[model samples]
Target: MQKPEEAYSIRVIPDVKIVNKGILHTENKIEGEEYRSYIFLNFERITNKGYEASPTIRDDTLYYVNTKRNSLVMQKEFGQPEELFKLGKISKYTFHDKGILVIGEDKTDKKSPFVASKLKYRFDSRGLLRSRLSLYLFSHGELRKVVSGDFDVTDVATNGKRIIISATKEGDDYGLGDLYEVDVETGELKRITKGEGTVVAVAMNEKGEVAYLGHREGKTPWSTAKVILPELGITYQCGKTCGNHVLSDLFDGVKDRLIFEGDVIVSPGQEGGEAHLYLLSDGKSQKMTDGKIVVRSFDYKEGKLVYTYSTPEKPVVLYYEGQTYDPNPDVKGLSPQRVEVNGIEGWAIISGENNPTILFIHGGPHTAYGYAYFIEFQYFARNGYNVIYSNPRGSQGYGEEFAKACVGDWGGKDMNDLLLFVEEVKRKYNLKGKIGVTGGSYGGFMTNWLVTQTNVFSAAISERGISNLVSMCGTSDIGFWFNAVESGVTDPWTEESQMKLMRMSPIYYVKNVKTPTMLIHGEEDYRCPIEQSEQFFIALKMNGVDTILVRYQQDSHEHARRGKPKNMRDRLERKLEWFDKYLKK
Candidate 1:
């Protein structure tokens, strides 16, 4: 049988930003493998295949970062490219009053060594903190270093005078960071935000006015972030905020989505699982873009809106004036039936009649399974298994109350929501044979927890799941603060806190789990870590439950969504094999 990855060959285009030449984005075939970029000038490919990224416009001319040479390149009006500042693997860059504010690192800088001296020493995907990113103001054919300190500058926005930057110091704040303002002349760095929640997206005006998309404080993981105009002391929050709340196989931070165009501020907003572009002006928020689509990245200027978006039926495609530039044109994937049950929103993709069911859970209890194309879901459907996934309590896109509903109660009502979804789905569809459950990250935790509570599922697979909150604090990256905040055990060293963590842990109840289970994890996944899977696998093995552990080398938390094609194909084949072995028999 043809696999779904082969049948629905998705060409993922992410890091898309609008430019004068049209839109610039990186396209790849195997999910988050953004190795090459292209410029769609009048919907035509302008550049050849190379490791290109961070495409930006400076005074009508296009410039992008070339990873192969570790330098910046200039693409002139669908013509040849010129290599500019040869920085070390440019992370992000923007033009200033004189030239460009380059946010990258120096490859051979030995003055300051990257020491893991802080409480939180590492981050997910990027691995350990090895280099310090410096800010440089390039002017008059010369580069001047701006602020290079203990903080890591991830993003920046400038009106040519005062530059607004979102950075995190070598503290224990995790992702919760603050913003700063730097004078272009004196290079005077001033604090803007009070280190509340993370400043995910930022924009600035000529008057040094600033508006950012972030949360005041994300008490729970599902807390909805807000768009704040701090200079005017105005906050425009209406069931929305900027960031990638919609979960998919594509992996890249959505930047340049919030921009100040003329008098209006265009920002992305989420409502119920679908995301769209919104215009914020004079304290009022207006929904600018429409449809059941998730707007990932966009650029708007002078009433023209060009955005990178996706639906359950389509992958990431550029949209402007009813025109779409699809990187993958001929590939067609299965669509889903959107459903809601007891305030829980879900999608069901049916491939055949009376087929076995696969209850796929989304990772981040914070991230929602929205109206976006997912190859894994299509993979299950192509194998004659109906897929059902839902966003229950503790999911974004819903209001703050709904999002925070599962704050300290992970396996309580959230578990009920999944159970209710399965019940409603089976009642609504002709689900025959046996049902299998699978999920990664937080979804993986739920998959493990579900089998312990009920023996309904015949086979279960948990990828990069959390089994013990107490041990997670000591082992995983962001585990100390993240597990504490989510479980409300601010101090896990205490006896009571340990009991609370144990009560919420699926491993604590492994004795009750009778379903045959399989564990898959990456060797380098610091977010949930491989130890999480190892613990669960051993517990199930000791309990005499049919279990096996599959470990992928040199892969991280995103191995399933964005791993090597060989490993990804093997994962899909194993998934089909496991389900067919148990469910088909």
Candidate 2:
């Protein structure tokens, strides 16, 4: 959708030190591309170098892990980043309120079981570290390493029971994950759930009781059970189907609201899987909102819930200095237009006042395309493409019932939703002759799926997508979990596996593809590893399909989206070029 004159165009946010950083924190990017390398934290006035994506702010201090440096640093007075500890040869340092913590094998003279360590520090009410404490490692040697320096901390939360710290880690197989809770004080560690396939999410109530989500294990795709203090001999179970839930967002600090470690559920597979907020009050659990909502953050003055919301239809707007600006302005220019496609309600975005549109497909067949801020979508809009993305059948923003509708169906009904959505957009926008499609992960799978099943779009780009369920079952980090849940397949390789998985796999229908397709992948990605791309690429080439494959060797499963600065820039450029070659009129 690039205008003839828009070629050789560059977008730079004027005077604003805002970087279009990826979602997860990692250093992976294509070489020699234009991108935002540094961004200044508006509140802390801290200028973060390299890729500083997710920031956790607490007590006026800001905490972030630099993937480029592979180190954790603290910044006070918005000064230079101070190195607190080197997790070198180990894993990256995770930031907590007191200090940075690392979890890994306790490698020392006395090797012990898995151990987690933290650096201690003294901080003021504003959250700037006043002094440093002995580096505390729960390892055997009994010797703690202390590094002296001031610290920067933020996004610190506590229910007067425990200090909760949020950070990310490189998973064994699924690239990097956004993790929470270092438990610096009580030495209690817990993983707050996000992404897909997470059965349970844990939180702490005011009484220090742990709340956890209890879902049916394995691939049976049962109901979800929200349990409060199940591990502490106290139990309150919300009896619901236990399908995989992805925590879309969270809110903390509600007056008289009891949130335990286990009282969280992403979107269950019943409705559209649209996320909703619930609270336990007066010994009764109550549903808060009825529509699709994602809790970005919470402001509690004396523990009263002020307001919380997320971007699903509109970009998140922030009021600053008596002025309002779209925090996700990349999506600011996009105008959300609604239309009914074959009796299915859907939405699409029109960029600016002109240009051909790119049909943006989201992953999670059960996930909904709501008002969320997506950088990729923004860039597509910035580059003069009307990027239209939606949450089809499996999307979470709808509700539990709609989300579950795609469970065993896979690409059947969901595929129809996308096709109908596109048809509706075309009719509404009078854009019948020009259209393009692209997505990653499940979205990627669908891109591949779409290219084979139909030639609706002029071009396609599939990133970290899947082609064959059989190979993906073994190659993916969560393939076992995915196969079991969606297809109810005990053995991915067996012919008797889910009929839909085989029928929907793009590789089975590659011969029907006529669109010029491009494949992008991260070499080390184990979740939806490079093998998925490779399988599709091989099939396309063998069938004489017009295809190209680009792989980022330095990245893993995450780097594809959240990799280095240079790589992100290159990816956008390449993607634009691919679409330009085919989609542009």
Best by TM-score: 1
| Deviation from native of the Cα of residue 335 in model 1, angstroms | 2.1
lDDT of each: 0.78, 0.51
lDDT measured at residue 492 in model 2 versus the true structure, 0 to 100: 55
Q: How much is 226 displaced in model 2, in angstroms?
A: 4.3
Query: Candidate 1, residues 1-585: lDDT per residue as tens digits?
Result: 557458335566666666665656666544343334454456555566656666777667778777778888886655688876787657777877678898887675545656778766666776665656778877766777787775677678987767888777523347766778877677677877764576777887666688888876744566677788776788887445455588877644444347876568888888877888888888788887778888887777677877888887777778777788777677566888887899799989987657889999888888788887787887788778989999999888887788778878999999999999998888887667588999999999999999999999999999989898889988887887888888987787789988999899999999999999999998889899888899999989988999999998878898977676567778888888999999878
Off by over 4 Å in 1: 4-8, 23-25, 30-34, 76-80, 108-115, 140-143, 170-172, 185-187, 238-242, 251-256
lDDT of 2: 0.51
TM-score of each: 0.94, 0.66
Off by over 4 Å in 2: 1-200, 213-279, 283-294, 299-301, 304-331, 340-345, 351-355, 498-501
Steric clash pairs (candidate 1): none
Residue 161 lDDT (model 1): 63
